[model samples]
Target: MTTTLITGANKGLGRETARRLIAAGHTVYVGSRDPEKGRRTAEELGARHVLVDVTDEDSVAAAAATIAAAHDGVLDVLVNNAGIEGRTADNGIVAPADETVDTLRPLFETNVFGTLRVTHAFLPLLNRSAAPVIVNVASGLASMALITDPEAPAGFYPGIAYPASKTAVNMLTVQYAKAFPNIRVNSVEPGFTKTDLNGNSGVQTVEEGAEIIVRMALLGPDGPTGGFFDAQGPVPW
Candidate 1:
């Protein structure tokens, strides 16, 4: 069977993706930091649970070992979905001028470094699969072209840290795809979905947001790699 692992699968887009992948006959592992919540969500979605706090190196390593032991050291797909917005109390993005090293560190810890930690730990297992896939859950805000275009909605976003971290994720996707020619590694834009990350302010639902993620996670060996895509199509770098 196709074995898949999704980080932050306890809720939101991650949970929905796990449910859909399970329904599609994948042996899905719901990766979360909380054991109780993870177990509950996995049970509800008919998936297995793996404890993973992407920001913690020991936690990520342990989770990888656990899944490796359970799945015979083979993981077909990995969805790096864990992230944070780092918005203020009023749900306001941090202004570019106010963005300092201290202000941006936390967001980078989880969204950028955490993604690399998990992907690095699971590389061995993913490599063992006949067709390995890596899906980095990026955002439209990470698009340089979209954010620079005067007419684009993302151009108006005031946040610097969050988008910068996701931009790093897109770079990671590109480098990983180049490093591992056999594995289909790509980043995806979920399209401003309603979730806790935005206090449910997004225009679309979780179902709509997970469309590109699910589509990319199910890519075959011959599928496109090293690209940033959304539900509509390829997103500009």
Candidate 2:
């Protein structure tokens, strides 16, 4: 059975992804910054727990070490799901660019850079698997094409910080795919779903949000890599 580790797995989309993977019979590891929360969530989901703060180098290293030992250096999937929505600036596009930059910086610390940290640390373990897959939990708001479309009412038209961070994640995903052709690396937009990040304003459910992620995680070796997709299909970058 493939072993999958999902960062920020304590709640929201991360928690749902872990639950789904466990139900599929894969050994799932729930990675959270808080041990209590991670352990409890894992216990509830019938999976393992790993304390991982993607923003902290030491924490990320320790998490890799723990997982490597348990899985005997073989990790099939690494889900870069830890991210922040960043604070909102009420003023739409005319909002202070600094506000967006400041808010986005912290999110990137976990979303973009954190992804690199975990991927680099766990690559050896992933390489040991027959089919290694890396799924970056990006969003449709990350798409510059969609965000810049004046004709369409896209989700990207709103938050500057969150969308920009996710865009960076998409680019990072592309780079990872290039760097490791053996590993399938792709970014997926989970669409707007009811979750804590949006205060549950989304029209879709968490199960719907997790569908694309779980699908990407389970892709075969011949599956497309370095692509951006949603539940329905490919999303323009």
Per-prediction TM-score to the true structure, in the order listed? 0.99, 0.93
For 1-237, candidate 2 gives per-residue lDDT tens digits of 989999999998999999999988889999999999999999999999999999999999999999988888889999999887654454233234456455668878888899889989999999999999999999888888887897755743655667777888898899889989999999999988888776667788989999999999998899999999999999999
Per-prediction count of colliding residue pairs?
Answer: 0, 0
Flag regions of model 2 displaced more than 4 Å: 88-94, 97-101
Candidate 1 lDDT by residue in tens digits, 1-237? 999999999999999999899989999999999999999999888899999999999999998999899889999999999999998899888898989999899999999999999999999999999999999999999999999988999998888999899999999999999999999999999998999999889999999999999999999999999999999899999
Native RMSD of candidate 1 (Å): 0.7
Clashing pairs in 2: none
Error of 1 at 212 (Å): 0.5
lDDT of 2: 0.88
Highest lDDT scorer: 1
The candidate that achieves the highest TM-score relative to the unseen native structure: 1
lDDT of 2 at 222: 96
Question: How does residue 74 of candidate 2 score in lDDT?
Answer: 88
